[model samples]
Target chain A: MTENNEYAVECEGLGRVYRSRSLLGQSRETVALQDLNLQIPKGTVFGVLGPNGAGKTTTIRILSTLLSATTGTARVLGYDVVKEGREVRKNIGIILGGDRGFYGRLTGKENLRYFAALNHIKPRDTDRIIDDSLAQAGLADQQKTLVEQYSRGMKQRLHVARGLLTDPGVVFMDEPTLGLDPLGAQELRQRIPALVGQGKTVLLTTHYMFEADSLCSRIAIINKGKLVALGTPAEIKRNFSSIGVIELTLNQTRPSLQEELTGLDGVKRATTSADGVYQKLTVHVVAGADLSDKIAEVVGKDHIENMVARDPTLEEAYLEIID
Target chain B: MRNFFVQAYLSYRGLFLWLNWTAYISNVVLRPILMLLMFALVGKFAADSDAAQAYMIGMIGYAIPVILLGGILQSFVYERVFGTISFIYSSPGSRVAVFFSRGVLHFPNSILACALSFLFGWLVLSLDLSTLNWWTMIVSVLLTAAACTAFALFLGNFTMMLGEFFNLYNAAMGLFLAMTGVIIPIASLPWFFGDLANGIPLTHGLVALRGAFAGMDIGAVRDELLLEALVGLGYAIAGIVVYMLVERDARARSSLERSPA
Candidate 1:
């Protein structure tokens, strides 16, 4: 596996253990990544989905050579992440969810220029690279403005620009849509596929299920530093085909409603959504189980207006896998 | 070499241009002068005019290190606070090289601030340049700048490795200003401080600067220059070792996954 260069990234039993100090100086160790194995092929859009602390960022950082795994081996373009870290760094780029990556004091163009220099872009090629990146990020017009003056969305765009300054073969995007308005997130989302079209491998981690469902060619759902499921969206949903989905519209929803619904026999997961007047509840149950009567009994017929039994969605499949 | 200079220039422009000239001058120049003025006043009352002139030169010597210290603190803090450490560390560029590039970038400003401080001293304090040993004065000042910049690079790398310690930097600068013969002659102080002065970079540098301005021969000040150089070398080695250790730990522990900010 270590000898193979066919895959963009390959990890075999990679793990990271962190030791931190408490306020009273008590030492604690945290296992951020367990013995995880993944083989991400070239030019594919891979999505890693997990709740916070599930090791999504750890995996990305390790593969990007920003961090090293304490145990096992990982490789990027067949170069060991720990041993050939500089080579790995040269081949990859990363965009974090947080807005604190660039120098706010510098202009957008200046920031890109600086990163270009760091990347060792030839002096003659620096300006052209900066211009191309700024144009690609849609910041060419505003490139002269200080980054501090740019909006959060604009800065995020600039981040993507800097990430591409090196023209890396693989790009790791960790929750890129984390703190953006709907339109802003949608705009960034629209820009991702273009990278794929250019034959650049992209590894994206997002909490937004729809973002994963829409963008990823392959999605891996992780929980507690373990890979719970890895497959295409259709394949993952098909694997959970035995889990039936029941939707209910009730007059009022209580926080305990999900817990009560999960308590019913054969029900694996339950979630609630509110839309102004109606409270929408979704439950995943075993396909053969008779959940209809119990769901009605739990919600009461007076409170239940509408109910629909259907197949599980990508999100329901994800929840069922994680659960 | 080309990449290094480019990065250095970028670091300089990114940092210094952020603050307007007025703010830069007032903070970097005016504050140090005010501190010097207090010492100058003391020199006038407690000692003769030559001592006063020595105070002026010493005050000028103190300003560059202060600027260098400030620049180091700001650059390291900016990366950590702005969450750019991961971006920089992940780059293909050598981390040590990047650290020095920023340190090098701040050198010119340090030089400029020191030059302005001296100009202010010459005009306001009635300083006479002809009596000074021009060769010794030039050599000492340049060597001091080199030593100070090296020390600042050490601090920058240390902060990068640890991910915090702006307070430590503050304490260090304070100690340098108070105890490095900048405001007080080491010989006049108690034996411990005077002995401790040999270990700090600015001590020998400042001592050599005073000797130069008092028309001391180059041969007479060679020992001080050599000591200053040795201190700078010690800091360079320490900084490199600490930075590499921290970098190794960061890799093993995956600290970048946990945001320092």
Candidate 2:
């Protein structure tokens, strides 16, 4: 009778409301998530893209059974996240953001062993699993070092090691590359696809649009605690094909120049940025509209240093949707 | 059972593996001896020979419970402050196992503290031990540890539920210390306070331990040991129930990821 057994994770009408009391004794309710729906297919990397307070962490917390939903239901691997929490926990690994979660006094290998024990991984396999995890996280050489002595990137890798100790079928990573350097982030990104290649499902949350576009098989965009769009990266990009984007740089852009360009008949949207020396402008054109004459008529060619027009990237499409 | 021991050992390592040899020695040995000396000096001037003997035995008997229970309570607070409580809660293991695992470190520490304190009092204080019943003392010390551990487990759950209550709980340790009759007789207090002492674990434990240390016959202290064990059982059940309830509430409130504090 289940609707989405083939999916690794499915949630319907998921909502969470936090209650707080003010000094005046008036109760205030903050809705962290509301009427959210999601379905992550098995063995695929699914990305949840959103700004902060957009319910990304709340969704992961609910799916991991670390928090209960106020309305609706969520399931993982055909088991209800709330009703069969233990079963859900058994099949999933979680890595939340921040470096404060682990015991700094423990060694990297020791932390993995502790989590492995807590997860009830077989005793005979504990050593093998820990060694494999440490190696996978690129910490085998430094496994004996205390966690407090590790750099931020090393600790983040240790988080990955801890998450993989159980070999979970599904992994929830909330902003896993949040504080890492570019090289560290690239290395972690390389490891995520391997998990999916092994028939594991990865649910990743990130604010970085490029990361989502390149790493995820499907991307879901959430804004203000609501899902605004859900589709594959190509599909999301294709949705904006009716519009064209133009990049225009000026020696110095005046405030009135941007207003006049925005007021042009064929221009759909105009965004401007001034870098003190040069003004960079992005202009979106409506489909089937010729904006060259309109741009020429609005501002003289002398004001424009360089101008090029092209299709939108995922980031542009995202800004178009959210803005 | 294997998981329990593994967890216990890992947790012990987490709290102590980073310490240097001297810090480790101080933590496990020197600190307890110093505490015993301070108590011995207090007993020397405060009362007559008979009262001083009672004070020495009472302090030595209850030292482990106070030290270990206090440490267990502080570790729970530190777990919340360090943001690891959420990690433990999200694990697939039973909450009971995690609670006991995190609290188990203090178990051996308590036993060692009691032994060192006992030795220090016996040697430096020159207390008469001719009639001491080693078997009964051993049993009483273990029972006292169990009872106090059970009590700390309850407090751990309570402080975990309301994170800010940790400060209040830490400040109340003195109240529990005074009420447990370690340094003062429970009977000397008013009737209400004396009756309240019966509800706290370790009061009867201290009474039974005093009997063992004074070389009283086991028959004379059998009732105290039984009462101590029964109290321990009651708190164990109550502690488990409270833990489950608070854990459920925390899950509902989304407090596990970040404590209310």
DockQ each: 0.61, 0.71
| Top DockQ prediction, candidate number | 2
Tens-place lDDT digits, model 2, residues A1-323? 25676899999999999888999999999998889988899999999987789899989999998889999899999999888988998899988867777778888888888888889989999999999989888899999998889898888888888877788999999999988889879989998998999999999998888899999999888888888888998777667445678788878666687688878877877888885688888888875576866785576788788888776777877776776
lDDT of 2 by residue, B1-261 (tens): 898989877776664332457765775577667766766677777756666677777767666765665566656656666577677777788778877776677777788878887887778787668788888888888888888888887787766655644475545557556887887789888669999898888788889888887787767889998888888888878888887787788788866557444
What is the C-alpha lDDT profile of model 1 across B48-92, one tens digit per residue? 777778788888888778887777656765666567677777888
> What fraction of correct interface contacts does each candidate retain?
0.79, 0.79
Estimate TM-scores for all models. Answer: 0.89, 0.92
Top TM-score hit: 2
> What's model 1's TM-score?
0.89
Off by over 4 Å in 2: A240-243, A248-256, A266-281, A286-289, A296-308, B15-35, B162-172, B259-261
Among all windows of 10 consecutive residues in model 1 chain A, the one with the lowest summed lDDT is A233-242
Model 1 regions lying over 4 Å from their true place: A240-242, A246-283, A288-310, B15-18, B160-166, B188-195, B216-220, B254-261
Q: Judge the docking of candidate 1 as incorrect, acceptable, medium or high.
A: medium
